[model samples]
Target: MVVFFDSLQGVLVILVMIVIGYILARSRWFSPSSSQIIARIVTQIALPMYMIDTITKDFTKQQLAQLLPNLKYPVISMMILFGLSVAIARLLHVRKNRRGLFQSMFFNSNTVFVGLPINMALFGPSSLPYVLVYYMANTTFFWTLGTYLIQRDGEGTWKFDIFTTLKKVFSPPLFGFMIGVVLVLLDVKIPTFIASDLHYMGALTIPLSMIFIGIAIEKAGLRNIKLSRYSLGVLAGRFILAPILMSLLLWRADVPQLMKQVFILQSAMPVMTNAPVVAKLYGADADYAAIMVTESTILSLIAVPILMTLLQK
Candidate 1:
């Protein structure tokens, strides 16, 4: 019971930030364009800084080596989940218009925005490296295969572009992570003043991220979210099967307890917040994607506390 309450306390911290964003958005403080701005700042500026700061300061070479091998756990889990999502989509006869988005959402996750904070809340700062390991896999897959499927849902055909795929895959956050890793491997030292700057800038990542999510939910309009076979399918994929698959993969593996917990928690995160944007860009069902983003994010609040309780046990 104490563990459950402690876990709930962590979730409550997240809920409060979300609510602030929701309220401020309702007041029209955040324009529709604001989600884009906040996302850019977080992903491009704040998140990268966070990575550089954490990696250069907090992580050790030994920890980095161990973290790299464990990347297989998330990558393999996502691949299996992708296959299963395809099966479920077929079984349900999901419409071609939104089917690609459905499967994409099922297999991918909001690793940075929702997953990061929740893990931080539940497990504290130590969970950051494990969360980043999962993020690397999630981001690469999303930019390549994930976006391709989203494009498939559009009116036009999607031709594969290696350069474009590579650009997106090696995104700013990932690049920041890469730079940090290199710095660590070379055993280089960051100047004290610059390190302080990185710390201040990186601090914006979480609160702003939560606020962006709230604004996104507000923009999507909660009333528009309803469970269809498609939404339910996505729900099952995210909240149920994803974690189970991750757990199975990690079951016999020798790894740190924190890594296992972060992996499982990340596996159950909501649909990638980028889903609707990519859908809109591709001329697919952006509204459907937006609704699922809202729906799954809302449900994850409920799901996290429950899962955390079980994990605490």
Candidate 2:
């Protein structure tokens, strides 16, 4: 019961942020262009800083060394999840333009925006190291293969450019992750003033992301959100299939109890808020992505708590 309420509280906090964004949008204080600008700020500045701050603050040389060996769990788990998502998307005969969106919805999650805060809330600061491990895997694949899936589906082309693909894989967020890891490994300390500045910037990631999502929802029109078979499938993939699969994969893993719980909880997160942003940038079905993100986020209020309760048992 406690687990359920904690999960519910965390989700409600995020939903409230979204509601605030919606109200602002309707009042003309926030526009579509403002949403885009916020998204840019998040992706380019806020997210990277958050990544660096969180990773450095939470991890140490001995801790990271301990985590290095277990890195295989998340990496392998993500690969399997991506493969399953691709297979399911094809089985559903998801259209070409939306296939990328489908795959991303099924596999990647709102790890930065939703997963981080919720993990902290549910499991406390102790969960940060495990969260960072999962973040490393999630961020890497989302930017690499995940980007490819979305881009190919959006463009309906198979033209593979090695240089372009490589470029996309090493994104700004990933760069931050690498830098943070290097600093940790070298036992280097960031200047206290600089770290404080980065932390302040990092704090903007969650509210800004949720607000951006609310702007997307406002643009999509709440009344217009009809749950198509495709949308239903995405919901199942994100909320149902994902948790089940992750549980089965992690059930036998030799890890701490909290680590397993964090992995499962993260797998059950709502669709990535950035799905629409990525779709729009890559010429995919941005509207479809927006709808999935909005619907899944709303549904997560119920889904996350239930999953948390069951997983706790």
Best by lDDT: 1
Q: Candidate 2: global Cα-lDDT? A: 0.78
Against the unseen true structure, what C-alpha lDDT does each candidate score? 0.91, 0.78
Candidate 1 residue-wise lDDT, 33-137, digit = tens: 888999999999999999999899888888788888888999999999899989999999998877888889999999999999999888877898899999989
Candidate 2 per-residue lDDT over residues 112-197, each given as its tens digit? 66777677767776786677677777776776777777787665565567787666657676677678888888878999999999
How high is each candidate's TM-score? Answer: 0.98, 0.87
Q: Which residue runs of candidate 2 sit more than 4 Å off their true CA positions?
A: 90-97, 281-283
Location of the lowest summed lDDT over 10 successive residues in candidate 1: 304-313
